[model samples]
Target: MGGIGIMIAFFAGILGSLSASDYSQYTYVFCAVLVLTMIGFWDDRKDMRASHKLIGQLFAFFLVVVLGDIRIESFYGFLGIYALPISVSYALSIFMLVGLTNAYNLIDGLDGLAGTLGAISCGFLGVWFMYAGYAVEGIICLGMLGSLMAFLIYNWHPAKVFMGDTGSLPIGCFIAVFALLFIRENGEMHPSAVYKFHAPITAGLSLMVICSYDTLRVFLRRIRRGKSPFTPDKSHVHHFLMRMGHGHDQVAMFLGAIKLLFLGMVIMCSGLNEHLMFPFVVGLTIAFGSLINVVTLKRMRAKVRKSPPISQRYPIKPTATIKSKSTWEDEPVLES
Candidate 1:
């Protein structure tokens, strides 16, 4: 429903030309999203192998680069690495694009989990773009958000159909592309109209931290365990919640809400006060740290509960072997 609604609205927006960038935005996202949707939808039904999916993603990424003219211009001062050579930026951009696609796909296990969170993230991003005066990127975010909102109609709790890899992969990739477009280049600042806040890149990262962090953590854990990172398992945060007695619906809601809460903190500070980026970051760090502590405590409690008590370790001996004596006494009486 949400997906359909967005599709309709995008078409309508294209027809009406609500914004100058709407046309280009719709066309670019439409083609890429359609291809991704088809590939993902098919993969969902028929189970496409990892190799095939990777190939498809590469094809999609190349298409965006060639047609949409998407490229990574800069890192926004995060790594102390500024202007990259053209070739390196191109390579890095594609990598980030594909990585985002898969990150969302991997996080799409529970109902309303991926779609809802994606909507929230994109909605925030879309508004930020509009506020920053990047109308094209803003429109892109809004269009995507609208589509995902429609998808959630069927994707919420007791989901009728999953978004599968088809939806997740493309959506993720497109978002990365959007992020690339939104970031400022080395020594090339955006126009004053585009941003009313401190830094664009930090805002982008904060918005996407949930998906990025989960993907990074899982990838590292898999590498450390000498396991294939592509292999699927019940290791996601949502899965942990499920194992810890959360119902599927509850898990989905919890993950989405947590993501929103983080973004909300960032927005409330950054948007309202306009100089609270530092405080926003600090607050997020504290929240995430506390979350980790809670999860650790739950695991410890579960482990302790599953173990046997000390009394069970040593069974008491029987008080007497009276059955044998009774049998002997009865036998003697019978004989007499």
Candidate 2:
């Protein structure tokens, strides 16, 4: 229902001011979102296999990349690479779309987490797009921002409504598109442009650092444990926070602050080259994730140490009479 409301609001917003050519440009995006929304709605009602969901996501992303021509055409000079081969571009675009969509989906574990993060990301992108003179994309980003703000009203701690896969999938995919567009637009900006980013790729990634890093961390941990990467488990960052005694609201706010911090870092470092900024952002994210895990583990161990022994906590009581070997007399037998 939240996802449906977002789509309705987005479409209505676009229909108001966009011309024919603008509508044509976004037709593929609309179609792809519709496909993703349907797939997500279906999965919400009848959980789909991970592989099947991947296939569905691939098809929707293909529409946007191949037909809509909204793909990463370059690496923005990261590692001395600029233009990419067509095949490589298609593959990279699809991988990013799928990865980000699932990353956002995975972070929906806590109330208001996903919606709050989504709003922050979309709001930043919207402001960037408008400042950079991309009205259509700006509208798209703001449309998502508006819906998310509304959704968060009911999705805050003690949530009245959950997004489920129905909202997460499409919302994630849309944010992925915005990130891609941000990278492309930033790269194409004139060198003298006031808002142009020197590290376009890194800037784009900073928008989703938290959830993407969490997803990558969870997948690696699962694989290391000899389990499928998609295997369900309570090993997410949110779960760790919960174990550390943080309430849902605290966890959500803490993560949201971390996300804003990343955005601020990217903005402050906008003049840095991708080579330097990329590694800095990646290192910071890994450090934060590792710190969370270490703190959570220590807290758990401390908790165990503080707890009383189970046998002492639940003492056995004498329930029957038994003969003692030495005394040859009746003695009380204690049963646990």
Model 1: ten consecutive residues of lowest lDDT = 185-194
CA deviation > 4 Å runs, candidate 1: 1-22, 25-29, 185-194, 268-290, 293-300, 303-336
Task: Please list the residue runs of candidate 2 whose C-alpha ends up more than 4 Å from where it truly belongs after superposition.
Answer: 309-336
RMSD of each: 9.0, 5.4
Alpha carbon deviation, residue 315, candidate 2 (Å): 8.9
Worst 10 residues of 2 by lDDT: 327-336
- Candidate 2, residue 120: the lDDT equals 96
Q: What lDDT does each candidate get?
A: 0.68, 0.88
- TM-score per prediction, in order, is 0.75, 0.90
TM-score of 2: 0.90
Residue-level lDDT of model 2, residues 262-316, one tens digit each, is 9998998888888999899999998998899999999989988999998999998
Q: Candidate 2 lDDT (Cα, whole model)?
A: 0.88
